[model samples]
Target: MNEKLLNNTACAMVAPGKGILAADESTGTIEKRFKSINIDNTEPNRQAYRDMLFTTAGAEAFISGAILFEETLFQSALDGTPFSKLLASKGVIPGIKVDKGAKPLAGAPGETVTEGLDGLRERLVKYREAGARFAKWRAVITIGNGIPSAYCIETNAHALARYAALCQEADVVPIVEPEVLMDADNTIEICEKVTSDTLQAVFDQLYLQRVLLEGMILKPNMVISGKKCPTQADVSTVAAATLRTLKHHVPSSVPGIAFLSGGQSDEVATAHLNAMNEMGGGPWALSFSYGRALQAPSLKAWGGKVDNVADAQRAFHHRAKMNSLASLGQYNDSLETVA
Candidate 1:
């Protein structure tokens, strides 16, 4: 691994006041987004929608990097510039999501194991040639009664580490994400336990794979109760729980921890990140790498109308700006609208 390249990749992904934009939705997922807006889910339509989001003016101000799908990485904008070139021109690093979708684990009934290790090295090489500086792979962990057995967590963690090692070898920073789903009626304590166990296993595999800790970013779900839990954790409680869990598990060698806003409302996700940063002095930098939580409002503002582009940009900018401030623990909702 080239030292400078690895470090540069890491820096680009975790630059301050600027987080990552997860525009890497799979075709089916993008189709779902298109369905909500009544747009056809054809290739050109999907490209156009992503083009609209990626080409938003000044998004580079709050977005240091963009995580993209294989299609977007190779596709050109309507103006003929490749998405990677557009991002590079604006000083934003481009990344790719390499996992070949999650497959149901064998003998583990409802759990999943992420696939992509096969030929990942070659894919990483091609992505780098196409100007991607980093990459992401998401591993899902579900919570429930007697579920997410050790076998399930370890399988996913091993894949994440394997992917990370390959990325580092190709001089690409890996955004290691092991997200524990909030799909059950579990308590905050359960979320904490699961998150802790997941990270512990993730890092252990990273160690076994001899992946460099400094050259990677850890993106994990914040420890909060299940969506259907009777009692919800307050912002402070959520922040404290998340920090305590990371403090006990993730080492200080890892540079930062940008969160995935799994099923959170835009403001709610930003508020949680803000609270975590406000608490301060944890092992890693707490920021965001949100998808739906960040894009939903902007997409709504757009309403698929060309005339609403400015409004959409404004809404997108607002959320990004808020999250940027929250990354520094200084966000104020009163300023959200005006800013």
Candidate 2:
């Protein structure tokens, strides 16, 4: 592992007023987007969409880095410049999502284990050569009645540690994402218990695997009630729950904790993050690693029309700007989303 490179990469990832843009949608996932727009999910179309994001006229204003899928890491723009090179030229670090899709854990029923780490070392070396400075691996944890057994949590945590070890060995900073899902109808207390347990297990595995905590950024879900819980948490409640849970499980040695949107409305997600930053007393830098929460409004505005590109960029820029503000505890939903 190159300690210097790891330190540089980690610092760049969480630079103030800048956060990651997760454009690393898988082929199947991109296909769904194409479906919405009546465009075929061909390689060219996928490349174009991603290129639009990475090559957006002035993305570096809020985007310090971009995460790409394996295919995107290799594909080139229309003029033949590789996307990785394009990002590097624009002062944005290029990262890759190394995890294969999550699969259902045998006997656990509702929980899933992320599969990667099979030949991960070779892949990391090649990605490093191909211009990737960081890599991400996500482990999904679900909450429910009689679900997400201890076996499921431990199995996922072990895989995450293995992946992290390989990343550090190849000079790549690892974004260790253990998302405790908010899809169940559980209370905020239930969500906190599950998230706390999941993070505790993840860090334990990281320690056992000899991973360097300083070179890793944690991407976790904020502690909040489930979507159908009949009672949604207010911004302050969500902020308090998330902070309390992280304090109990996450160590101060970790450099940052970027929260995943996990099906939250863009405004709500930003508001919650901003609230946490306002309430700040934590050891790690708090930020975001959102997907849909960062892009949904822009996508809906674009609607896949060539004429909508400028509008799309505008929408995208707005969302990015708001989240950047949230990162600094300065976002006001009423100022942006509220009319």
Candidate 3:
């Protein structure tokens, strides 16, 4: 394994004033995004949609890296430039999504464990050849009545560690993601406790599997209230709780923590991240690896129309810029009213 390469890429992924873009939506996922905009989810459309985001005039200024699905990694832009090459030419490292999506855990009725380790080593080699320097694997932890059992957390953690080990062996930095979903009606305190337990379990397994902590990035959900909760925690509260949780479990050796939006709105997510950065002095870089939070506005602007490309790019660039400022603790709520 090339420890230096992995660490360098991981650090670059969360460099100051920048964060990762999760353009790795699966076909089924993109279909939903497209449906919202009245566009078909064909391969050509998918390519064009992502092409718009990748080719956005100066998005590279804020987007340090982009995680892509396998099809996107191997596909080319309208001018025939491979998507990975296109990103690299603009100084953005390319990454891949290796998880097969979370599936129902055997005995845990409502919990899930992310799978994809079946033949990951070989897949990593191909992904690397396709210009991927990093990869992501997500484990889902749902909070509810008598749920997120020790069994579910351990199984997912073991899988995440195994994947990280193989990724390091293949010289690819892995983004370890254990998302405790926000779909419930649970309070922020419950979310915090669950998030803490999950991270502790994941790290324990990572150590047991000998995954190099310095060679990977962590993509965790912020410690926030559930979507169906009676009231939501404001930006400052979420930021403080999340930072506390990370300091508690995540090793300082990890280069960065690129948080997942996990169902947060764009402005809300940006606000939370900004609040965290403004608070200052975490051991590792705190940034984003958002999907819908970064792309929703762009998708709405484009609506798959050729004439709307420029507008879509503008919307995309604006979102990226906002998050970039948020990463540096320079973002302001009033900036949302600009442009």
TM-score per model over all chains: 0.97, 0.96, 0.99
How do all the candidates rank in terms of TM-score, highest first?
Answer: 3, 1, 2
Candidate 2: regions farther than 4 A off: 337-339
lDDT of each: 0.89, 0.86, 0.94
Candidate 2: count the clashes.
Answer: 0
Give the per-residue lDDT of model 3 (tens digit) for 1-339.
988988888999999999999999999999999999998999999999999999999999999999999999999999999999999999999999999999988878988888899999999999999999999999999999998899998999999999999999999999999999999999999999999999999999999999999999999999999999999888889999999999999999999999999989999999999999999939999999999999999999899999999999999999999999999999998888526
lDDT tens readout by residue for model 2, 114-167: 997789999999999999999999899988778678998899999999999999
So what's the TM-score on candidate 1? 0.97
List pairs with backbone clashes in candidate 3: none
> Whole-model lDDT for model 1 versus the true structure?
0.89
Residues 1-339 of candidate 1 have per-residue lDDT tens digits of: 986778767866777787888989999998888789887778887677677787888878888888999999999887999999998998889999999988999999889999999999999999999999999999999997798899999999999999999999999999999999998999999999999999999999999999999899899999999999999989889999999999999989887888999998888899999988888848666778999988998887776777887788778877888899998889876776734
Task: Count backbone overlaps in model 1.
Answer: 0
Q: Return the top candidate by lDDT.
A: 3
